[model samples]
Target: MRIAALLGASGATGQKLLPLLLDDPRYDKIITLGRRATGLRHRKLEDRVVDFENLAAGFDGLKVDDCYCTFGTTIKIAGSEAAMTRIDHDFVLAFAKAALAAGATRFAYLSAANADSRSPVFYARLKGRTEEALKTLDFADLGIYRPGMIVAERTDRRWAESLLFPALPLLDKVMIGGLAKFRSIPVETLAAAIAAFSMQRGCGTRIHHWQDMVTA
Candidate 1:
């Protein structure tokens, strides 16, 4: 049996991912530390609400074998680039730091498809910076899932995303080889893929995309 820690268990993808780990016989325990409770119960789950600004007390003396990070937000919803980075980048790195200190060896992070640290796009750069920061930690395995637009019924859905979601299937058909990574993926599939990646133990950093997740 193994122990796992999950951050952002309240989010769309994370919410779906939580049950997979809880039901899987391999993971004897699933610890979730987040700003809000996931509101779901499982025999294997231990959910805790904590302040992201101060995680030291929350993770004190905790030990987890693997950690999953699926928390993220948008610039529009955050109201500014700084706020967005605060949640997506700063908070993410903070969790990685706390998890590492708590003896986590494997870390799985959910990132954007075209994240580039040097990109002019704020969202992509934030994701890229977070990914880079996570690598500096001492995790033996770092799984960075760079999934494209996630398709799901979100309560806080963006106008643009709602308009574009209907066309994603048509767009996906034409997104052949190089563009395959950018194809929109369903939230359920993304969650399953992340869970699959978390189940594997290995060394070095690995990045996954649409094809990889679908096949996982």
Candidate 2:
């Protein structure tokens, strides 16, 4: 039996991943931490309500084998770059630290493609920084998933992806090789990859690129 903790069980990927974990008998318990109730039902699922700002304290008295960090936000939704980093970088690090303190030895993070510490993009920078921070932790295993354009049905429109998704076929044709890596990867694929990767026993970090995620 394995104990697992999910940080963003209500998000697009997290929501899709929940069913997989719940269906797996290998996971005896699953602790979901989120700002609101995920409305998911499972006898083995335990929900912990928490805000990102106060997550360290909220994670008290909980430990697991694998800690899945799927928390993320956009700059537009987060209001500012500082706020976005706070959640994407700071909060993520805080949770990882707290999880380690609680005896969790494996950490799984959901990052994005093109995540680089020296990137000109703020979101990518934040993601890269978070990944770096996770590596410093003394976890036995660290899995970082850099999935491509996650295709899912959301309540609101993400203007950037909304416009880009339609032109993916044409873009894929021209943007071949390393440059055209951002394909319309379904959310379910990314979720499944994470679930599959976390179950494995390994050491160090595994960076799953967008191209690899689509194929996985």
lDDT for every model?
0.88, 0.82
lDDT (tens digit, per residue) of candidate 1 on 1-216: 678988888889998999988877878999998877778877888888898889756687678888999988888889998898889988888888888888888999999899889989878888889988988889899999999989988999999898999899899999999999999999999999999965677747999988999999
| TM-score to native of every candidate shown | 0.96, 0.93
lDDT of 1 at 79: 94
Please write out the lDDT profile of model 2 over residues 21-140, one tens digit for every residue. Answer: 887778889988888878878899989888777777766887678888888888888999988888889888988888888888888899988788888888787888888888888998
Kindly give the stretch of ten consecutive residues in candidate 2 with the minimal lDDT sum.
175-184
Q: What is the lDDT of residue 153 in candidate 1?
A: 85
lDDT of 2 at 64: 73
Q: Clashing residue pairs in candidate 2, if any?
A: none
| Residue runs of model 1 more than 4 Å from their true location after superposition | none
Best-performing candidate as measured by lDDT: 1
Best by TM-score: 1
Alpha carbon deviation, residue 75, candidate 2 (Å): 0.7
